[model samples]
Target: MKLAATAGGGLFLGFSWTGSLASALEVVSDTAIAAGEINFNSYLALSPDGIVTILSPNPELGQNIKTSFPMIVAEELDADWTKVKVVQAPLDTNKFERQVTGGSGAVPHSWERLRKAGATARHMLLEAAAKRWKVSAGTLRTENGFVLNPANGKKLSYGELATEASKVPVPENVKLKDPKDFKLIGTAVRNVDNHEMITGKPLYGLDFYKDGMLFAMIQRPTAFGLKLKSVDATAAKAMPGIVDVVTFKNNVAVVGKSTWQVSKARKALKVQYEAEAALESSADHDRIFKELLNSTDATVRRKDGDVEAAFKSAAKVIKSEYQCPFLSHSPMEPMNFFAHVRPDGVELVGPTQTPERARDQVAELLKIAPEKVTVQLTRLGGGFGRRLSADFALEAAELSSIIKAPVKVIWSREDDMTGGTYRPAVRYRFEAALDAKGNMIGYKLRGVGMNSGNPTREDNFPSGAVDNLLIDSVEHKSPITTGPWRAPITNFLAFAEQSFIDEVAHAAGKDPVQFRLELLDKAKKSPVGEIKYDIDRMRGVINLAAEKSGWGKKKGVAQGFSVYFSHRSYVAQVGEVELKDNKPVIKKIYAAADCGMVVNLSGANQQVRGGIVDGLGHAMYSNLTFKNGAPEQENFNSYRLIRMKEIPEVDVHFVHNGIDPTGLGEPALPPTGGAVANAIFKATGKRLRNQPFAEQEELKTV
Candidate 1:
């Protein structure tokens, strides 16, 4: 590997990658003179000193896109990994595609594009080196920031060739390296921002501050179905550090010099809110679920063979219902955004999962052109799919426009928890029929949810495995707002489906592992319909998980296993539980996944581990319920979260493959609930049909 080359010391480093800082965050650095950096493309910049600047186009939500995405560019560019500096790219739709980071779509969508960007830059450097050496371009190969000629001992650093490479014509397409040659791709690279984060450096949205920016806090409607009717902010306006108090469509905003002042002043405002419609409680949601289950008005997603005949002829039938509560995203950092809105344009700087949509939403609200809005993204403290919506961003933009000055809006933890857009509470019913010999004959699923669209994964798993299978979905609209959770419907659906599969296995008097394997064999050999999951990949993960955990071999340990395919990936998990004081306690979990080629081993491991913890925690202790259109739990005191004491060791493994990468951020999560539920049943002889397993009376301790 060649050393990292630089463009030259004290040369111009001032190239506007995005645009001028149009808002109050107009701090300046870099650029001593003419920009010496060579713009190979929108994503890669080469300095004469052999420094490679790689732009990460997607938002980073601790899923490690910032580190992993740039690894792809560095891998193909043959740049020294230690010298490659990754910077978060601003929202530039013209140069980057798919800036959003949900559905685990970032890597799959940008894999080819990023590889091409690096390959193209490498090609230009080869041409430049060849011209300098007076040799054929094919004779030059790049390695660690250098173009080396094997026939001759001559080599040129990327820094030395940067100036000449800038003049070379970029090819229409460049060859990407074969997967076997990947250097940085699968390597365990540390997060670039780890030092800054551990040192408490300013990086997240909450840390953002400008010279003349004012802080604002909003007082929204207390209830979901209510709206602000009147506001008396006379006292709030008189408070110290208070700047202005204004009302928007549904809430009142208190602007002040600091967060503490705004927080205190917002409490002083007397706001009157009135119900715009009937206020429904958690009980109403429960009744709605029951109504939808019995109602014939359902959309049939998949149908195969004769379900009625199979059920009628079956010697035994097993039926079970599973329920999951609505959940708050509850990121470590509360919702916030910085907005500098002027008559001509707007500047939005904050932590958001969807920057383009945020700019678009603000543009629509203000009746301005999309180009008039510029969004600068900050490192997020956490998202968990919460930042996908632009509600917080819109609040800041609206308040900034009203105040006619740069402003940052912050949401109190209570405001963040009770705010709308929750993971919808859902109910699922599963029924399976078995013949006299205990051979599975039929399978059926009914999903009912509030504000859920196509709550059923009709094409997955047993849909193709069973001889007779049916899947149906019923969506009951409510005043409550709902959007995509981490794994969307699969978060709860997989738990219900996998647990029911386990129950059927037990009813058939077959080993749970053997039962799932048999089903997968059926799906692979003579599938009833088109199977969306790769049977080979799914089998790979399941077998890997079983082997790693020594399935059915651990003594005195209750074990449960679950496998699921979602977000274009397959994951299998084995949960081990131990009995303490006659109560089931989770001890450890083994997870195996096949998400194709991993970008970074360290990041991938952490993502899988984090997902496992998140899924298990929610299933074990988290629940959100509403009373009279208001959330019963506004903060952590009433709400529950997975604590350090409950978090067990999570062992992660991945199938070794060079196949193109799929999604990894959310796939490992969906099956964890089912695995834990199965393990608990083995330990305590109790079936947990609802989320917050600890809250169930049957299991004394979960």
Candidate 2:
């Protein structure tokens, strides 16, 4: 990466694959700018008018990176926040090392690199001012886009020194501000694209439009593990605005001038799919998982101490089975992508969480070099790990190549719901051995799940927090596509482990929060193996959540507590609820999180709150059951989501820490299901082991 001067009198920061930095005097042509905007070092650019434009590399999935990334740059540049503008950078692997946005690593990975870019620019401005005043560079300080000399009362605007600053040497190393001195960070800053989002501006993939772009929709196989055998498109092809019908290995596509026409044509077309074997249903999966759980032959992921000996000598033993149904991402904006595949190259514009993967997939499909494919990212309505797959973008590229015209492929809500790549349903068997004193001495867990070859994550929560622990896993092969959803495996594991822990706490006659704290303290003092979690940090959030929620106080509402760690962040949540006619009426939820340094307080809070709601919705009524390997719920009606009326007031608090920022998008989600389940247990004295609590007949009578 190098910073140079452009012919348009603006600073240019260009990234080269050769890893060589250009000299300050090197002049680049104005054509290097993409869309007439100055190229910043892949991240930061300075215009002649002093307006600083920062390029955000990560995809914005409502996590507020559009504002947070620029805030980091402005903080280090000593630039006026008001004058800073944030632009979504197009996906270019040569320019950025990583453009994938899942796993909540956007801020943690880019914090140092972005800060360095801003600091380097600030240093150049200071050097330019010093040379003009014939004073030492150390004597000048930058304040709000200006070089300031306190003693002489001299100040120069960054715009005035922009040309001169472009000629100064880029500093090899620059100083970053201490957290204590931050002005914009840790403060509540408004989202940069709030206005565009509120006024219904075109910022999403589905909202993208191009002249002469044909709309396309696909009719996927009726069942999983099926192939497109035959299609009758005569009736559809004669319809108004219908262009052509194409067939792929897995599905049939309908291409037309408008989305409505394409959708109607797809529905009008008759399709036949061929399956190799009889489609397996959810009942079959449940039976297979149960058999796996009972079988002793399983892969051991973790073992500490003698679990058999501990269990044999135990005075009491508690065993339970937990099951969670498969779930759908169900993003508000259904999967859509615009692709223009020409002889020269392929251009793609869409809402994808993994743009680099999308670019590579398109290149591979088009039989062109990766560089020939350009992916432009738009604001995503929601991801939840579904956008991590590039299938949607690849479909658009394929359709465009076949039609020889720019095409936008859209998936209806039904298509998105029944389409493949769902969160794998899992079953967990847990056993705990307790001594005469009610102290747990041994723990054993056996997990059976689909899609993931390894059903259990050995280093998940409570792995290193306990002694005499044994973790085993069994995988069941299925044709249904499955992928990461929210916190991935932790989304279901946390609920299982935390709810079991709550049961153990009740058996030991201890408060749930206190019991967890004691276990954390034990782990901190005498950890059995490599303790992956920070015991101190975990205890901090747990204590904070208890304090904020008045944990033990009776507020006429049953309270449930859960704590979990994921993606390098620790979170504790408490759900308060009351039984209303045998149904859980959630009143409030309090959450405490320690995700290191908070970038934007408001954004962090919203992420935690949003994650909580998402988890609660899944635990409450969201489920995707399959019969004959076909999804039973085709839309929001059957596959229910938490509505606005059902949302409870969520109170979120962050533990003030000076550590470098981690990720907040996922950590807060894993514990919400467990907390709500525990609260329901307290209210009705019925332990809800299965997810989608509303569907359980046992819970309805309680």
Candidate 3:
């Protein structure tokens, strides 16, 4: 390693190396730039005086990728984790492409790229040291940020070689450490942001602050397709602290110096809207669902094995209907955004799942090039697919641009609950034909729900139609807007399908797990053509769950298990329940999942735990109703979230197969509903086919 003196008492270091040969490395830095805000995703440089720097990338979503991703690079580069500094990645797609993170794809996708960056730097420095000693590069090895010649017992620090390494060409195709040889990965690492998260550090969008920034809140129309006929902002403009009262399409926004003032003023504003023909209430939506069930105009999704003929020849037919209501994402932190529109460009910062989408939307809204609009993603309190949209960012940008000053748009609990996108209410009508031998001869499934964007090609099945399979969906045109709640629109449909299978099994006096195993066997042998799920993997998860849960063992309580394979992940869960004081008390849950190539076991378990808790909360207590074309639930006081007091003892076990990883977030959600629903049936002996079974008037356990 070599260091050269620079003009301002700074230092220059250099390293040079050749691919498959010896090399030298060089780097230079100034020590005057004192410690600044930490950005963990960028390069770290140091001077002869030993000052350090780093670059941080991606938003710090509650799921801790902030420390985790950087750890990957630090581990491979052999950098001192403690001494390393951090800074956020600026919105420069050219320099840092793919700043967005979601779909559980971050760890798996970035693992290699980050490792190579570190390994290449380390290799170059090692070559620099080897060349200085007149030794073969192959004989020198880098370890813990140090280049060492084992034979000569000499070592050079990465800092000492930093300058030299910069002068060396970065080696292409540097060797990566094998999993068995890894020191940091696969080990239990706590979240790097735990201190910040717990201590209430300003790390989220809601905490954003700007000079001369006004607070804004909007009053959206009550119903869908309701045209705003008029609005008088006179009273609001007179209110103390109110800065400006303006109207945007579909709503009026009240801007003030404080959030409370804006909220209060918005409520005081006089407004009128003209209701459209579709402004029918909750009862109307229910009626529409019923009509969909009877409608003959449905796109067939799948068919298999002369299903109609088999139904005709069967001795018994069974039918049932299940319904699910709309739901809000209800993240702990409500939607928020901070926007500053400068004449030259716009700077937008917020908690968003899709930063790329936000950048595009802001660019379009401001009529500026996408490059001119800077989108800064912050840590979301939670994002169960809700943050995927940039509506909040767009709204804030619009308000800020209108004001010609920096503004932070915040949604109160009420605004967030009623104004944002929702999961559409859906109904499922299921029917089955059974033979004398208790074999299913035919199955018919019909789903009705508000249109959720456009159903994919897989949604309308003719692609993999089974011989007698019949799948259809009737869409009820909706005025109430909706977005992807979790895993497409199939969340409710899969719940109905899995639960219906449980009902059929109970009628046949067969174990629920065994029933599913049989179906998987049938699907594998002569699969209802091109079934969406992996039969082998599905059966494997089911069998494993059954074995691990002691399926047939009696514990003086009823237990039911269900398996669902979706999003390329397989999940099986057995929920244990006991009737207490006429209420179902969930005792415990055993979950077995195989999301191939588990990257972070801790994060994987977190997803499952969160999913189970979410499912239980919705099944037992959550429901969103509508009255006169408006949502009935407003905030936590009305809509329920599973609390610590209600959570069951959850045991999550994963199959440690070294296969490619799959999604871990939403796959755990669908199966949990059916699993708990089945357990309720076992405890009560009353077939519970609908969601929110706890709310059923005639609900009973046996």
Candidate 4:
């Protein structure tokens, strides 16, 4: 969906895809949305009692997209923000489009579409009031819940004209509110689920339970390459509260009346598995990376100019290697989903980032028509790209189908850590060639990883700035599964790329901030290749970050600078480090983002802060290794997370603009590792090339 915001907040439909817009809105007819009563299909619905309920389509995953999405509709509807009750909308593919949430795309995907919904409803209300007064809608205006006429000083609440508005023709196009005239937007509105959350109400999937529903616990293969061969569940079935024991595919599930019963019974089951592939370990991955990095054969992702010639004639050549261990997507709430597979249809309720995918998967597994499947979305405790995979939901459906009973599959923390998709372990090799004048002439990057796609962003920053650049990758298909983790490749790439750029700048005897500005200027003016980033916005955030952090002027403290553009957002961060006991102590971080517009200031701030903290903690102390195709860090006992006292004060700044908002869920996270690593380098002369910096001697506490 190609959408651009016009000067007057009008939605510009420049859909490049064939028949997508037509097919997406096929469910919404003019009269369907013109109903006088509340419609759950569309986002906005008004009642005769002046009650406004805005449906949030996407699952709430602590990113605050649910609250902010509804705010968009409410803002354009001119409804009282306090009066509107936001509700989680179920997956109605016929009625809603892109009900899934991932890639930090919830806002950018729903922005224009949601605005049109609210504006169209407002247009209907205006016509309803105009018809009642026997006047043209041109003279009618709306404020709060009332449609008004300035000439007569008379107005009618939207509730009063709800019935009459049902007959008004839905406008093909309605003028969207200009950003400058926004009333509820840019305000620090609290999260709609804040009260329910703080009061410990049941909103998350872990809290979801249905009457007569059984709880099932599956015992998956203990190792990645291992497959379940047999399960001796005779003893487990005899245990107390154990309803049944079923073997589906390779997993052995123990079903019971409650979580505790099933969990306790699962321990009694003796599951045996055999290896289907060679058992691989962390040491094996390191060997594979070393072999791939040195191998001449590699897939060239992007090539521009003559890289070999530029490097051969260069006056200086610098080379470095960075590596990161695999990471677990340990969401606070372990994966859980409720599924009821019946003879006629199937029902699925859970916290899933992609509800449609879950529904379709379950339907396919059950050999049922797609229409026979229904999905109900619940609040997610945390996704972090883990919930994007419908594995947990599918497990529930499969078990429920075989057992002929509704069951909720709950993953213990250990099960989740050992049997879930992981962030791929990766190694990046970077080489820079400089001319006699210290100008970068040639740049080369080759990434080696396990199950990572491409692992290179060739069109990102510094790509167009350089005259000669070559990007390539080599992948090792491991038996272990890996999927998107937060910002995906950029989460680790930004740290390596930005840190390398910092090194290049220092080697060229230039300030880090000024050096980045120069690159952005190069990309903006005369370039080499197609640059995907907005140079102006990148420059703006970089300058803003430097200005806000006192980048160069600060004394008795070391500061490092980094910036990255990801998920349609540009974020520049400045990190400060103070040496204590000869160890780099993170003091504070200043973040400046150009996500175009601010939807909710409070939520946006929390997002940036949370991303920074998460990124910092992982880069500094988190790592998941494999000794024999099994995760080494299976729980918090072995896994390291940043403590409250270790968290630095995060100061966030947004480049306020009238442009449509992009994404904040993942963009702010990518640059954080780079900033923190750069700051550590500034404090200590040694460079930390590996992730989970605690593994490096420099970061080890004395």
Total clashing pairs for each candidate: 10, 0, 52, 0
Which 10 successive residues of model 2 have the least lDDT summed? 16-25
lDDT string for model 4 (570-644, tens) is: 999999999988878899999999987889999999999999998999998898988788888889999888889
Output the TM-score of candidate 3. Answer: 0.89
Question: Which stretches of model 4 miss by more than 4 angstroms?
Answer: 1-36
Which one wins on TM-score?
1
- Candidate lDDT (C-alpha), each: 0.89, 0.86, 0.72, 0.85
Candidate 2 regions with alpha-carbon error over 4 angstroms: 1-8, 11-40, 581-583
Pick the winner on TM-score between candidates 1 and 4. 1
lDDT-better candidate, 3 vs 4? 4
RMSD of each: 3.0, 3.6, 5.9, 6.2
Give TM-scores for every candidate, taking all chains together and pairing residue i with residue i: 0.96, 0.95, 0.89, 0.94
- Stretches off by above 4 angstroms in model 1 are 1-32
Ranked candidates, highest TM-score first: 1, 2, 4, 3
- Which sequence of candidate numbers ranks them by lDDT, best first? 1, 2, 4, 3
Better of 2 and 3 by TM-score: 2
Model 3 segments beyond 4 Å from truth? 1-56, 78-88, 96-98, 453-467, 698-702
Task: Report clash pairs, candidate 2.
Answer: none
- Per-residue alpha-carbon lDDT of model 2 for 1-702, expressed as tens digits? 222232345534543311122111244555565222344366777766667778888899999988898888889989988888788988766566678788989999988988888888888889989999999999889898889998799999876777678778777888888878888888899999999989999999989998889999999888887777888999999999999999976778999999999888888988887887668799999889889998878999999999999999998888988899899999999999999888777788999999989988888888888877777789998989999999999999998898899999999999999998899999999998888887788999999999766667788657776789999998888889899899998898899989999998898888988888777777878788887778889899999999999998976799999999899999999999997876778899999999999999999989999999999989888889999989999998888999999889999998987999998989999999999999988988989899898898758787
Query: Tens digit of lDDT per residue, candidate 1, span 489-509?
Result: 999999999999999999999
Whose TM-score is higher: candidate 3's or candidate 4's? 4
